[model samples]
Target: MHSRKIYTNTKAIAWVTIGTALFSLIFASGKFADGSASPLQILFLRYIGGLATLLLVVLVRRERLSAYRSPKPLSHFIRAVFGASGGGALIYASANMPIVDATALGLLYVVFVIPLGVLVLKEQLSSQHFGAIAICCAGAAIVMASRGAFTEFHMAYVFPAGIAVLGAALLAVEGLMIKMLSHSDRTMTVLLYVNAFGILLMAGPAAMQWVPLSFESAISFILLGPIAVTAQYCIVQGYRLASLSIVGPVDYTWLIFAGLIGFMFFGEKPTLGVAAGSAIIAIGGIMLAIIKPPAGEHESTSSA
Candidate 1:
């Protein structure tokens, strides 16, 4: 009984950590957005920060870089390209739009993944999945339309929304790749390579549009990587102690956190429409989470 209770508690912590990390991501992105940093510059700082954290880990563990090898070099390259593209789009979107709005738009990826899985990865979608997708999309539409009432529609919204879809698709691909590679690769090895390649790919473009950083911006940029790493570690450790199903819904806490931070930091107020739409989106996401795919049905690569 004690062990079970401990396990439950750990899982709770893990979910909280995941949600908190996501919340941190919103704030970090918002900071970049408010600064009006170029998309390339934002990407550069994010990748550099992430890479530096991984390098520090490598050093502390005394792990040799050569120890990490990919069985599918081409796949890694492709994944990196897709990942970088998504990152670039996100940076652009985040910088130009409200943080909560960007996040809401990004959530549409969950809806896109449903169809992409069936078409691209040949995964079967059950009726429940379809229903969930429909519900989620409805919620997303509500959110998007709500935004239109307050602000004039711009081409920029399309960019972020499109990137969100692409990012979701890329993430789905990455998951499949990870599963295939896990046959021979350690998790850390795959992560290291992904980050390394991602950094290399973004560096040149980011440098082309670089801006001088204020002392505060420099500090924020530097801290971003370490915070992300710590948050990820906490999440991993938390999962080890708890059931995923129980912890999964807790991840939505980031939305609340994002809303709060967005309002406080940026003075972005949530209108009734935004609130109603967000609630619907949240409900759809939760439904998707709770509903299971049917037996004998292969889950799609894009479902994540």
Candidate 2:
């Protein structure tokens, strides 16, 4: 049992590292896309690339699409809607904001997921979790305040912020669904459905806004899709090997990487307030992750 636990912890760290790196790549790619493409065009390319990569994986594993035959097609559809919306929001934000700022806001999904778990999944919430949420909110506020993100009131800022909130909600729902499906479905299958359905669903809106893609933009789009896929896969693997609370907080490490990448590539620097707030948020998340709720206590609240 001790050996197993140690192995699980190692896997968790690996997942966190891999997941963070891929996400960082995704953010960096988004920054790249912003320079040359529209959000819709980027979304279309991402999905197309994701779909192609998934198809190749399926073929290599000889996994039949029939294997993904789900009785809950509606659930898959819902997941797709949330996933697509989240993607659109992130891409939109990346186009307008500095990559780090966009990523910082996007990380709010961690805060959003906690309440979602409590209310939707009927999980219990502890005081520690509440404290964690509070900390994360404070952090988010700090980042926003430091960046003067609220003062501008421009579409670029406003739109992505809205999307970030929406994305967090969607991701919370996705977590519940994943937990439910974990009983019978493999993570790959769940991921595959989400990606495939997301591509199909987003294609309509994306097509409406479509512009012709250049060779450079096409490559970035393709790469973005695969990076996202790989990140999700790594996350799933991490979850499979350990408890959610253990692996979840490590995901927040993305902010650090985002900050670094933003500085290195875009010459964007976070202000003291943003840095301090991000630290608070990271601490709160870490506290929550390491805390084991009392037996029979839920880890979220109804208002989450």
Candidate 3:
């Protein structure tokens, strides 16, 4: 029993980590598609890609079409609304701002998730988890402030940065909804519905603004599908296997990954602040992996 709990917790951390890295790239890739397409168009293409990948997975498994049906249709709808809009906002902000700054701002959702989870889902926030999250947030503060890493805030970016915050808040609501869905839905079912609904939601807006894409931008958006499938699948499974408070801060890793990827692909330079802050963030991530949530309830629910 002890071993089983450890296994699920371990798997949860792995899923969130891998998914977050891939998701960072998905957002970073938004930078390429910016001018070539509107945020809606980019997001639409990405969803189309995600749904396509999911269907292929279904085909490979030879799963019945029925496997996609979920019991929580309204729940999924709310999640989709949040997912589509929040995602579009993030892409819009990412397209407009430096990738690291946009992402760090977007992570404001994780901070909100704890209280939101408590109020909405009645999830416990362990002291250990809260402390780790604080550490991560402190690191995030440094990342967002560092001249070498984050772009200095200017009134010029006020709109998109504000949009980024709105996006984070919406995604936080979406996270609570996902926690409810994860109680019963299969990971693929969770993602399939989100992509299906998200695609439907974006199609009209995206169509209105569709524009010709460069070869590079075209490939980048096309790749969003597989990345979406891989990342969302891992994340759903992680959520299924762990508590919200425990797994939510694991998202801090995305900020770190975004910083590095932004440096390589977007020419952002890193300095001592970036190095030091990231290390502190890494410590928090380690805390998440090692710290157990209150044992009994987690194990009780997890064994199912």
Task: Name the top lDDT candidate.
Answer: 3
Q: State the displacement of the C-alpha of residue 22, model 3, in Å, after optimal TM-score superposition.
A: 0.5
- Candidate 3 C-alpha lDDT tens digits along 10-104: 78878888999998887665465546667677778888889888889889989886967887888898899998889878878877887667877
Worst ten in a row by lDDT for model 1: 295-304
Candidate 2 vs candidate 3, lDDT winner:
3
TM-score of decoy 1: 0.68
Per-residue accuracy of model 2 over 1-304 as CA lDDT, tens digit each:
4444445556555776688778787756646666576566676677778778888987998878887667777776786776677766666666676654665677677666656556765656567656766666677667666766545455657666766667666665665565555434666676777777877877788778777778876886877888888887776666555444445455566655666687878899877876897688668655654555446532210110
Over 1-304, each residue of candidate 1 has an lDDT whose tens digit, in order, gives: 4444544544444445464655467355646466556556665676667778887777888978776666777777776787677656655666666644666555544444345445654655567556655654665566556656225446767766666556655654543444344334555555566667877897898788877878777667656666555554454343333323223333444554555565777787967766775677566555544554344533211100
Estimate the TM-score of every prediction.
0.68, 0.76, 0.87
What residue pairs clash in candidate 3, if any at all? 49-225
Q: In model 3, where do residues sit more than 4 Å from their true spots?
A: 1-7, 92-102, 148-161, 214-220, 299-304
What candidate 1 gets wrong by more than 4 Å, as runs, is 1-33, 90-108, 149-184, 229-257, 297-304
Q: What number of backbone clashes does candidate 1 have, counting pairs of residues 3 or more apart or in separate chains?
A: 0
